[model samples]
Target: MEQPFQFKQFLIHQDQCAMKIGTDGVLIGAWTSINENPVSILDIGAGTGVLSLMLAQRCMAEAIDALEIDDKAYEQCVRNFENSSWGDRLFCYHASLEEFADEIDDEYDLIISNPPFYSPSLVSTALQKGENSMSDARKKARFQDAMPFKHLIESVAKLLSKNGRFSVVVPFSEEEQFIKLASESNLFPLRILRVKGSPSSEIKRSLMEFTFSNSKIQSSELIIETTRHLYTEDYINLTKDFYLKM
Candidate 1:
């Protein structure tokens, strides 16, 4: 059985979310820049509503909306949002990104997502395989499925307010493709941070932030740990507020 959920000072209750609270969410939450003090924010695919809660705590935004497609995750996200100290400012919707984008008339000042990055892959367990197959079948059936990377970038370009920013975490291998896709959609990359397990290890993930305006791209690297037993100072500093054991 899964362990009972826990709450941190900065994090509200986070239970019943298939994707548990983890370092990647914290990294993206901390790394995203809120230069304009966005009045409105959107968290796409907000599994546990952790990212939305973090933004609410970090910035003085007037409204924050979290979107989740999975029924269980959406319900959990709603519970987490309502239980948070900033419950009045936080809200969640049980809808896919495409559906939300289509219905949303007002543009968002900031948008963020830790998207579903896993491509089609085989699973070993029979139950797991069955679930994967069902999800895949569902995807294939929808003419207007949740936006692909290219479509996601395009939608962001259309939905972001002028001078707005979009931040996301994607696999390191997809960085080049994503950059190209964003460029094609007229969203220029403003900043990028390549994440590695350690200083000497290969890059594992990429956290990128983009803006509507054309600007010089800034790139940096983040090393999470020096060794398995030692966490890097920078890593700890970024997530200290959220991680209980950090």
Candidate 2:
């Protein structure tokens, strides 16, 4: 579990970061739209720098910035970026989204996040095993209070370029509320990808893309596996370029 995640073209060291590499970040990173060839990109709550690094591999974005609020995660993210093939173009900013939004004048042609989702009042089943097993920073990485959905959308609205697309991954149950929040900020959905763990499993997450202008919303579903450890064609096709085993 301590080993660096080896992508097809880059290596991510997540030892010090509270949040380790996971499917959610990888899904949004590989599924994010690159049709426009954005010149600049920003990743909010970039744990381990996986999403930013994925984009660095998929497109020639002149600059790719990642914002990580946790100090340990931020430092690890920076080290991961510097050790990557696109070191010069990648950067990690150690600041809250509100703080980062306050100081930056430039807008991102693309914005992304695999954000905090756990309810503040409810303890997660995994954490119940041993509440103290997880670090404080890791807890913040997954909890809404650290960066609530409202603030996340507002930050996206403020920093996203007029024509840019913002991509995010969240629990399926939160999709409508998340969209409503984004709509309030004038960011409308362009695409939605519902994701399931297996063909028979209920949808677990939504991979969404939004922009300032709207048209007909494109919608689809992605099943990650046919069975345990057996990848689906759609999932493998979506991430084959990045994941070595895919």
Candidate 3:
């Protein structure tokens, strides 16, 4: 069943997109810091324009652009942006990160994304064409297409202003690889938070923040729950402003 259109402190209407508003997007949006007080922001692969909206609510950026390659997702993102109070500051570009990075004239003070990371898995038949379109044309032709996490990071590095920040959320297993890739692009890790379901569970996701300069990195853990039905105080504190039922 489709969820109702709901509004939160930092999130606006986001119901029409295939990707509903979720914790991953919310966490990254709220957690990402603007150390230099960015004047411009870019959100790559913005499924429902949630990240951009959050940033708009939190910062007074001159312009906030969201790029989505998928047609349906792009359309929905535009709608979500238009409906928000910060609609004038937020704009949706129906283009992929590669294309946007190439044509955009100005660099961003902050670049963020919740990239597609599923790799070497069985894709559903219904999404085969969409998956193929996301893959590099040459790689798709060779049947070696994979989610382009590296490409995303490299593009971000090119489009970020000096002293800018890049933030993302990826699976815990990919944190090391992601850090290595970002380093190659001259984007060094500044902070990392490992997220686990419970105290005893393995870390399932990592929220990472990087910058153009090499800074002393801070690492920490976030346990979402103390039990199946109970959320940890820290988790609640982090998300209380954005979750309606919290």
The Cα local distance difference test for each model comes to 0.80, 0.90, 0.79
Worst 10 residues of 3 by lDDT: 137-146
lDDT (tens digit, per residue) of candidate 1 on 63-134: 998888878778878888887789999999888777887888889999998876654321233236455444
**What lDDT is obtained when candidate 3 is compared to the true structure?**
0.79
TM-score result, candidate 1: 0.86
| Model 3 TM-score (2 dp) | 0.86
In model 1, which range of ten residues has the least summed lDDT? 137-146
| Sort order, TM-score high to low | 2, 1, 3
Candidate 2 lDDT = 0.90
Clashing residue pairs in candidate 2, if any? none
- In terms of lDDT, the poorest run of 10 residues in model 2 is 118-127
Model 3 CA lDDT for position 113: 85
Q: Report the C-alpha lDDT of model 3 over 16-65, residue by residue, as the tens digit.
A: 45566777888898888976789999998887888898888888999998
* CA error at residue 93 for candidate 3, angstroms: 0.4
Score residue 143 of candidate 2 by CA lDDT. Answer: 75
Best model number under TM-score:
2
Kindly report the root-mean-square deviation of model 1 from the true structure over all alpha carbons: 4.1
